[model samples]
Each structure stands twice: as structure tokens, then as C-alpha cells.
Target: MKSGLTVRSDNYADVLDALNKLSGTDVLVGIPAGPPREDSPLSNAEIGYLQSTGATVEIDGEIVTLPPRPFLDMGIEDSRDKTTARLKLAAQAALEGNSGMAEQHLEAAGQIARD
Candidate 1:
């Protein structure tokens, strides 16, 4: 389907130019939670520039007003760590035969994982 920022070239400069052409539009930028890596498609600097253009940014389903550098990285790591810890707790609860507690912990884990 045709979506936002459609362009005709695969070059980085072309893609960026197309994005820049989107000025004055209410853009919704959705970024998944994850640590930045060398091979990431877009650098944190680029994301910050995009946000500076007044685009509404959503990280892991929550709307945020900050740039996408340290803030997004921290949020991603925090959410991942919480999800892992909750999953461990759920397993421990199950081992203790506390089915109710295990279920609750598992539900919490799911929510955090989604984030």
C-alpha cells in the first residue's frame, strides 16, 4: 500500500531528501525498542533531526517528546530487562506451585516484552 514518504530511489541522499520534503506534515515516527548498533538503518542523529522537525515520535508504543538517542536506548534496555526478570520470576513461581502468581508474572512479562 502507498504510505508516507514514498520515493523513487534507494540512495540515502534521495531517501533523506524525500523525508525533508515532508516538512509541515504531521508525521508519526514509530521506533521499536532496541540498542543502537553500527548497522542500524538510521543513526540516532538522524532520528533526532526528524524529531526536531516536530514529528510525533512513538517508541515502543508510548509517545515521547525527547530525542531518540540515549532516551530511546535506555527505554529499550529497561523494558527488555524488566521483561526478562519477570519471565524468570514467572518460572520460579511455577516451580513453587504458585500457579496464580506465575500467571500474573507471565502477564506482566508479556506486557513488558511488547513494550
Candidate 2:
């Protein structure tokens, strides 16, 4: 797919010319997240500049630690639902080999079911 400013060339001089033209743009300048091959020197330089300016940098297949897992942000009991739904979830989890999660859901289901 043709990206915003993707420059492709077979010769080194042509590649350098493309990079020079793209240097003045607001686009992210750097080798994409993969093998640091291809016409990527300009991209590497851009990554360095971005890092120096406090921008988070991610390289090939690097898992950036985002804020947190979404589940960890919410309390378990906040998932208020009917007993049947909880039991179904528990059963599904059990069938899927998630015994711990199943037990948790089953416990919640049992509490609601008993009431």
C-alpha cells in the first residue's frame, strides 16, 4: 500500500534525494518496526530525534507497555449481571480450560443462584 510519504528507489543517490525531500514533513521519519534494512538511515535518525524529544520509541516487534491491562483497571464485582449469565460464563470458561476464571465466575454465579 502506498503510504503517505513512502520513498522507494533502487539507487543510493535517488534514495537520499527522497529522504531529503521528506525531511521537512511532519510525518514520522524512521525505519518502520522491523529489520533495519532498506532506505532506513533517515528513519533511524528521525527515531533518535523523537526519542531525544521525549517521544516513546518502539523498535522491531517491541511490546510497548501501555497504561495497563484493561481488566486490571476495573474491579471484578463491577461486572454486575444476572445469575444465568454468570453461570454460562463459568461453564464456558471451564470448557475452555480456564479453571481459575471458571471457578471465579462459578462462585459468583453460586452466590446469585442461591439467593
Candidate 3:
């Protein structure tokens, strides 16, 4: 006397798709590209990195020092709460198979990073 039960359900394809879309995305934060700095040849990104970490160089035969301003970190910290909330919503939407909402939330998080 043995009994077996079978459960039937549609595979959670939407959830899978959302998970794929949200994962492995590279988020960039900080200044966008622009014309080269008048005094420095470094690109905006390079300048940002130098400012974030601090650097020194000689210009016009005079030494200049860059302090660790950490603006990138500061901006992230400023948006930390809102970004995290969006990320959480994205995750929850993905788990619930709400792919569209998940993607929207993910995009909002990206916007937070950009701004």
C-alpha cells in the first residue's frame, strides 16, 4: 500500500528571465566623458580616480597635490538608502515572477548610480 502525489505548475520562466537580466550587470558611477581637462590630459574617469584616491604631479614646473575627496563614495553613500530599496524591490519582483517590475526597479537602481 504505497501512495504518490504529483504537483503540476507552469515553470517560473518570468522569474528566470528577470534573474538573468538583473545579474552580471556592471554599474558605473561618477562623471561621464567630456573634453580633456585644460590643464591635465587625463580623462574625466582618470581624474575621478585620482581625486578619489589622491595623487600628486608636477604641472608648469610646479607640484600640485590632489586630495582624496572620495566624491564617488560620497555620492553612493548619499543615494545608498534609495538605491538599496529599489534593489530590494527588484529582487522581490524577480522572486515573484514580476519580470517587468523587476526590470523597472533595476533600471531605477541604475539611475541612482548614474545620478
Candidate 4:
């Protein structure tokens, strides 16, 4: 039962490392949604939400009405083609068993998404 079967794992470490980084981890674009920072009155996400959905508030005893803009939605929709190419590259890298390269591609895609 001792057949000489040699297994090569030259890229195993890199692949594992890359998988750890890739699994359940992804880039998020746009303002983060959360409460305001300690020093700020509003988070960027709050501002964006208000702008996208519109709101009415009473300021100094006067009622002010805001209009819906949906800028974030428009931006995400517009960037569809921009990041698709990079994501495809990442997929190719993964298929070729080059995990490190795949991670790079994913990073590039994230950057494109952010941009």
C-alpha cells in the first residue's frame, strides 16, 4: 500500500491565507450607516439617508421640507459596469489556483466600487 504518491502544495499557504481574507469579507461602498460620532452632530450615512429619502423637520420654529435625491442608489447602479471587469478578473484568479492574485483582483474591484 506504499505507492509513491507525492503531493505538491507550493501554493497551499497562499491559498489558505487568501481564502481567510476573502471568506465572508467584502468591501462596502458609500457612507457607513451608524450613529453620529462623538464630535459630530450627524454621521455621513445619516446625511445620505436624509438626502435620499427626504425628511421634514422644524428648525427654529419653522418647518423645512427636504427632497429625495437617491444619489447613493444612482451611484451604485451606475458603477455596475465599472467594477464588473475587476470582479471577473478575481474569479479567473480563483479558478487558476492563484489565491494571492485573486485577493489583489478583489481589492481592485473594491477600489473601483468605492470610486
Candidate with the greatest lDDT versus the true structure: 3
In model 3, the Cα lDDT at residue 52 comes to 93
Best by TM-score: 3
CA-lDDT, candidates in order = 0.57, 0.49, 0.82, 0.76
Candidate order by lDDT, decreasing, is 3, 4, 1, 2
lDDT of 3: 0.82
Q: Write the per-residue lDDT of candidate 1 for residues 1-112, one digit (tens) a residue.
A: 7568866645565434433433222312235435555775556656655654545667778997764344544554668778779867766665555556666776777666
Tens-place lDDT per residue, model 4, 1-115, is: 9889887657677666655656656767778788787876778788788889999966678999999998877876788896888778776776556777887888887777767
lDDT of 2 at 14: 42
lDDT of 3 by residue, 1-115 (tens): 6568564765589778877776855555678878788877878878888889998978789999988898888888989999999999988998877878987888888799668
In model 1, where do residues sit more than 4 Å from their true spots? 1-78
Residue ranges of candidate 2 with Cα displaced over 4 Å: 1-81
TM-score of every candidate = 0.33, 0.28, 0.75, 0.66
Model 2 local distance difference test score: 0.49
Q: Is candidate 1 or candidate 3 better by TM-score?
A: 3
Tell me model 4's lDDT, rounded to 2 decimals: 0.76
Error of 4 at 9 (Å): 6.9
Q: What root-mean-square deviation over C-alphas does model 2 reach?
A: 26.9
Kindly list the per-residue Cα lDDT of model 2 for residues 19-114, writing each as its tens digit: 443333232222245544376544554544454444443557684533323331132334345656976776666555555666676667656533
Question: How many angstroms is residue 89 displaced in model 2 relative to the true structure, after the best TM-score fit?
Answer: 0.2
Error of 4 at 1 (Å): 17
Output candidate 4 Cα RMSD.
Answer: 4.3
